[model samples]
Target: MIISRISRFISNFDNLLALFAGACAVLAVLFVLFLPLPYSEDQLYPKEIDESSPLYPYERGGTPFERADIHVQYPENSPFAGYVTAYLTPFSLALSRLTPHAGTTIVAHPGGILDEILYNTRGLDTVVETTILFIAFAIGSYLFRKGS
Candidate 1:
């Protein structure tokens, strides 16, 4: 039937699918490695965080994720800064599911290469994004092999 023909036609493109998926995965990782996520101070830390109080997950150096700095803040001077940030770090558009700050907006800063490298070093965002992309690659490979 037509459905069977369509299925076979799709299966024949498995290799192409795999290649495209792999390339996308690599690009996603690169973006994460070279993008600085924009976050507010409250989003980066707990609302009641006390750096000098020595409280767990609240004090300075207590959180596992990186802190928000001026670089990560949305530029007030530019009206299109938010749009640019969201566009550059599209992966962060996902709903905030990480710990410490659940109700926070996550976007990437349009920073230089060095800024990207330094900002991503201490956060779990890059790791999470990379993992998701890796999973996508694995699934694509599996499908490709299954069709072969």
Candidate 2:
């Protein structure tokens, strides 16, 4: 009886949070649609990503997705699967160039970026994110269980 009451409280809280989120979404849409705001205009017509920005070398004729100056030589039998995988997910190559060459070590490095992403982030950000996901999944499973 106590367990059932506790579950009911938690389930009610979860439902309230969901409804609050939905209401916020609707409010945001209505606000954007009805109100006249300066910054919101940018959302409607975004500034064209400045091609001539020194970060991305500008070319008169260049591939839409690719930069001009930075030449990417595709490696044979790379960590990536093949040509299609490499093209679809160019992150491997991009990370190589973008990542800092030095000052990355904290005395003892644990493997690669995967470990860093899994472990290191802004303090409790990962913990909070994981908690939220876990709660959501638990609530969803409880609500969508086989019999009831």
Candidate 3:
């Protein structure tokens, strides 16, 4: 009788683990599907400059077009800036999808603040996805073990 009880206990444990694993797999798939793609209008494309255009000289700062210069300025405290920073990681990952040099730059000069944001955001997303998948798998493993 003692031996039978021990066997039953072991079986129960196995069922729990299986349920957890299944749950994790399901959640991982769902997250991958629902996760949003990151992007920004300003950073989406390279700024265009025409040699004959008056704004051409001001592309890198020294120009009569003050607003154009200011547009590229990084405002770390701004809400938009925060969003940009938060999504930097995702953006970088997205970039990598297109090319090999996605997250290669440690501190993208002049774009440091934005780059930091992107890196941090990507890190956060990875963590969250990992956690969700882990939990889902745990639950699925548990259920499977019990059913077995």
Query: Global lDDT of each model?
Result: 0.44, 0.41, 0.47
Per residue, candidate 2 scores C-alpha lDDT tens digits across 55-122 of: 22211222324322221233232222122211212343343345433213311133222232234322
TM-score preference between candidates 2 and 3, better one: 2
The deviation in Å at residue 109 for candidate 3 is 24
Candidate 3 regions with alpha-carbon error over 4 angstroms:
1-40, 44-121
Top TM-score model:
2
lDDT of 1 by residue, 1-148 (tens): 9999767766787667876888999999999998998865555212344333312222222122333232333345433322221232333323333333422233223322223333443346777878899999999999999967
Kindly give the number of clashing pairs for every candidate: 1, 0, 29
Among all windows of 10 consecutive residues in model 2, the one with the lowest summed lDDT is 79-88
lDDT score for residue 39 of model 3: 69
Model 2 earns a TM-score of: 0.25
Residue 57 in model 1: lDDT: 25
Query: Per-residue lDDT for 137 in model 1?
Result: 100
Ranking by TM-score: 2, 3, 1
Worst window of 10 by summed lDDT in candidate 1: 54-63
Number of the candidate with higher lDDT, 1 or 2: 1
